[model samples]
Target: MKILLDFVPLVLFFIAYKLYGIYAGTAVLMGATVVQMAIIYFMDKKLSAMHKATLALILIFGALTLILKDDRFIKWKPTVLYAAMAVALAVALWGFGKNFLKMMLGNQITLPENVWVRLNTIWVVYCLFMAAINGYVAAYYSTDAWASFKLWGYVFPLAFIIGQGFYVARHIVDDTDKPAEPPGDVQ
Candidate 1:
């Protein structure tokens, strides 16, 4: 259900672009994103920082696209968002000595500190690559081509996530296999 909600706005944007154009697609994307956020908030009673950032970007870039009658702003939105994420991850990992990715996932998955650092590095590199590729496509391609890329480009993140899953799988603790401690024993 959450995954479906996440894709709703992107799917709507693609369909609207195919049927109408960039402007209509932008408007639909904005509305769909707002609806998605509202649903998430109502269901979860809160929003993650990532969700808020994405919502803010869509609103800002979508409004610019609509008001200025220019699609470039909307086209650049993904690149900007990705770049910002890359920077944030880099800063948190290096400057602040924090592995945010690990901080978020550590409770659920147990891995060595080194593994977490490697994971954080992978995320930073992935985000930078995504941002660069998106900017390149948006700058070098036609609007129609860019629109197609926007839809098809989802493969990148999907592939990245699958790869990450594989990498993390090897490190996930199998608590079931551990010997049970004596009842009421403290350690």
Candidate 2:
């Protein structure tokens, strides 16, 4: 279920683009985003891990991009969101010496403070890199090309990241009642 949910963004975008070019797909993507948000909103009481607000914001901005019929909006959406996230993570680590990421996934795994800090930095930079890569493909490639990359380009890297994260978590997990460290925070 988590894996499928992870692919929601790319899956919806691809289906949208295939059914209706960029414009129509943009609208469909926006609509689907709203539906996803609605699901989270209604399920919040039942589901503990869902992020409703993020889904809502995505739908809102995605809809605006579609209604305005400007490709730039869709293109910039992920770029800005991701880049801003990277900067925020970097700032948090540098200024506060806190590990926000650990907070998010700390319950699931145990890690040390220093390790969490390093992982946070790496993941944040990775997101920024993804944002840059998204922008580059959108600019140089066709819509189909970009859409395909969005759906497929991430598969291997994501697989690696998850595998690595789990591996690290399992290794660092303490058996006794030790305090958890922060993780690399992400949306």
Candidate 3:
């Protein structure tokens, strides 16, 4: 359900682009994003920082695309978002000595400190790679080509997530396997 909600705006944008054009598609994207956020807020009763940032970027860039009559803004939005994520992850881990990925997920799963560090590093690198690829496509490709890439580019994230899941699964501890402690009153 959450994943479907997350993809609604992108799917709508692609459909709108196919029927109308960039400008109309931008408008649809912006509206769909707003609706998506509202539903999420109602469901969760709050929004994560990432959710807020994504909403803001979509509205800002989508508006610019429509108002300025430039498809470049929409095309470049993903690059900007991904680059910012990379910078934030890197700075939080190195400059501040904080592992944000761990902070966010530590409650749900426990892993060795070393594994946490490696995961954070992997996230930073992955974000940078995504940003670079999106930047390359947005810079060098036609609008139609970029649109197609936008829809198909989901493959990268899906693969990365499945791979990450496999990696993390190996490290997850199963408490059920531990032996029970002896009673304190044992003779």
Highest TM-score scorer: 3
Note the Cα lDDT for every prediction shown: 0.93, 0.71, 0.90
Give TM-scores for every candidate, taking all chains together and pairing residue i with residue i.
0.92, 0.78, 0.92
* lDDT: worst 10-residue window of model 3: 169-178
RMSD of model 2 against the true structure: 8.2
Identify the candidate with maximal lDDT: 1
Q: Least accurate stretch of 10 residues (summed lDDT) in model 2?
A: 45-54
TM-score of 3: 0.92
| Total clashes in model 1, counting residue pairs 3 or more apart in sequence or in different chains | 0
Off by over 4 Å in 3: 175-187
Off by over 4 Å in 1: 176-187
lDDT tens string, model 3, 1-187? 8877887898899999999999999999999999999999999999988899999999999989988999899999999998999999999999999999899899888888888999999999999999999999999999998988988998888788889999999998676777998879867
Model 2 steric clash pairs = 101-183, 101-184, 101-185, 102-182, 102-183
Between prediction 1 and prediction 3, which has the larger lDDT? Answer: 1
How good is model 2 by TM-score? 0.78
Superposition error at 141 for model 3 (Å): 0.5
Clash pairs, candidate 1, are none
